[model samples]
Target: MQSCSSALCVLILLITTVTTSSGSASLSVTVKLNDSATLPCSERCSGLVTWTVSHKPTDVLAECDQTSCRSVKEGYQMIHDQYLKGNLSLTITDADFTKRDWYTCTCNNKDICDVALQLEPLRSSVQMKPGETLVLDLDVSDPVEVIYNSRANGSSGHICIVDRGSLECTVEYAQRASLTSALELKGVTPSDSGVYTIQVTRTEEVIHVYTVTIQDDLPHPDRDQETVVPVWGIILLILLVVLMGGCFCNVVVLQRRRNIMQRWRKTDGQRKKEKKKEKWLSLT
Candidate 1:
């Protein structure tokens, strides 16, 4: 009878342990570089709340009891006002690649939740001329593999896998595709214009999903026509100003000549009147 009781107790203990270990809920959060990210905890817990790095359980990230909050990590802190309202969410400022990891949140010294921090995907587009090279700018700081996919032509494959500063590529893409600070594809054609999806992987797990649209290059504006039009306009304006000035000078000169002729005629008439007066006075 005692053996049967012991066996039943052991079974119950095993069940409880499994339940506690797997029952903890997990939350995923995506944050941009240099931005702030929040890891949510329970809002109803009143006692002590502790956050730790999941892989390194001994590393405490932050802690908040009923009365106060403190941070053990450099960039992590608990919102004070939220803590007063029973929200024990942790905020990490200036998030970067080094901050991406699994974190555990425990309330009352019991593991209650887990958080997965991921980097936000960057979305952009690239324009390239036919038979020209295409560059996909991936401003990544950590090790990652880039999977390139085309939606229109169904040319979906990985461009390169970069791990710890080492790069490897498949045989088909080895000749045309290369990895510098970014992914570059040589001799792209019009058929390559489509929606390209970039999947950044770390340890075979996708950490970021970026969308890039490939399109034909925009036609360059006719710069010569633009320059010529403005130059002609300025030349016409200057010519119009000179013509107006010439017309004004001619009108002034004609007016002055007419005034001088009228003055000469008046003087001649006065001389004739004087001669007639002198002849009449001598006869009298």
Candidate 2:
């Protein structure tokens, strides 16, 4: 009876481990956007080996046979040489947010390994002046929560939610917050400077992190003087153009009077000659 009990306990433990391994991912691989990632699964298989995602088990991502290896989907592949050496790793040429999920590898239709492909948070840095708008990319289609940490107060809280391509914000940001592909705040002040984290609402996995710095709207000592110089320069330019135009008009008027006086003098000289001829003819 003791032997039976010990055997039973061992069997139960083995069954538990097998179940957990099949249901959960044994490895977690995180990579940045557009970076290549290799999900390692070293197991020799004489027959065909296949890789599939948990979301769609029927769809194959990569497959390999003893003769050769091929990728069923674009951007995913299994190296032929590596597979021959018992390395059944799935290589993603470009890791993206859309490809993040739990992936499974099978040899001859038997599950051999499970891996979680997670995407690293997209980091962003922003610098803006007071009264300017702030925008942070959500970077995921699924529902997510945006948490804001204030730089001044060193406090943090949920600021917004993204769902079904829409957004909802807290009471403090309700009037100013909007969303499209990203979360936008209409008028941000220095107090609003801080980090904004966008994470999955259900899983709480971070998708995006933004560090925002809002510069203070301090008054410049020469602010008025700087503006006044441009205004004065513009006024002086206008006055100079007007003075040049007046001088041109005065020269035109004087030239026109001089032409009229010359014509009158020529006419008077011709009339005096005609009178002298008439007096000489009358004397004759």
Candidate 3:
């Protein structure tokens, strides 16, 4: 009978412990963004915890802690837990609207806790031609990420390219920082022409768009050949006179030679003398 009584007490204690631990979710955190955001959990029960982010309760934007965070998973990013600083807060290096969503924090053998967030709007500036260099012109309070070449999906905006794996765009942009974000491209081309938007996220979000157009370099016409000379100009008149004088001199020289040749061919001395006199007369 004493043994049965001890067994009943042990069963009751186990039942109470199970009931106390069930549905014990933490009620904390209204919004999170930019830097690391903490979602408080029962530290004692926080073993093998997982943090996941979803937009409109459908699209998972990012996941952190001991699980799969595939970039292939639509709008998903696996954040580094060390970056979070153990605040249970999601550390968004470059916080973006596309990343805004409901993040659920689950503790091993414990209830899940969640927080709602709205990432501010953001954009990129400097629309440029394909293969043309583009200098990033922007100012913002919050950190921003300039992504290219990778399959990076942001809630606010994205840079679209013709080819997926072209490293040209990668080398041109994608420098992230806390205070400033800038990028420069080398030799933009026609395919690079597009709507570039500048995205800034702080307490308030702002975006700016710029239209870019690249004109083809035109060949210059030959200036020396294009210049025209007037027909009645002094220079033209002088050229004509000189040409005529040359022709007249050629005619006179030809006639004198013919007469001299005829005189030499004459067999009689008297006839040759007569021919030479004719030649002199012709010249006179």
Superposing all C-alpha atoms, what RMSD in Å does each candidate have to the true structure? 6.8, 8.1, 20.0
Off by over 4 Å in 3: 1-42, 54-87, 120-284
- lDDT-wise, the better of 2 and 3 is 2
Off by over 4 Å in 2: 1-11, 17-25, 217-284
Order candidates by TM-score, high to low.
2, 1, 3
Top candidate when judged by TM-score against the true structure: 2
> How well is each residue in 1-284 modelled by candidate 2, as lDDT tens digits?
99999999999999999988665347889998999999999888999999999667789999999899888899999988998899999999999998889999989988888899998898889887788889888777889999988899899999888899877888999999987677889888888989999999999999989998888755544775666667788999999999999999999999999999999999999999999999999999
If scored against the real structure, what TM-score would every candidate get? 0.64, 0.71, 0.25
- Least accurate stretch of 10 residues (summed lDDT) in model 3? 160-169
State the lDDT of candidate 3 residue by residue for 104-195, as single tens digits: 65555233566654533334344333455566544433443333322123223344221222212332333311111344555666544555
The reply for model 1, stretches above 4 Å from the true place, is 1-18, 21-23, 31-35, 43-48, 94-97, 107-109, 141-143, 202-217, 221-284
Q: Please report how far candidate 2 places residue 231 from its true position, in Å.
A: 27
Minimum summed lDDT over a 10-residue window in model 1 is located at: 205-214
- Tens digits of per-residue lDDT, candidate 1, 80-160, equal 678778777888988886787899988776788889988776566556567677776655556666676665767777767
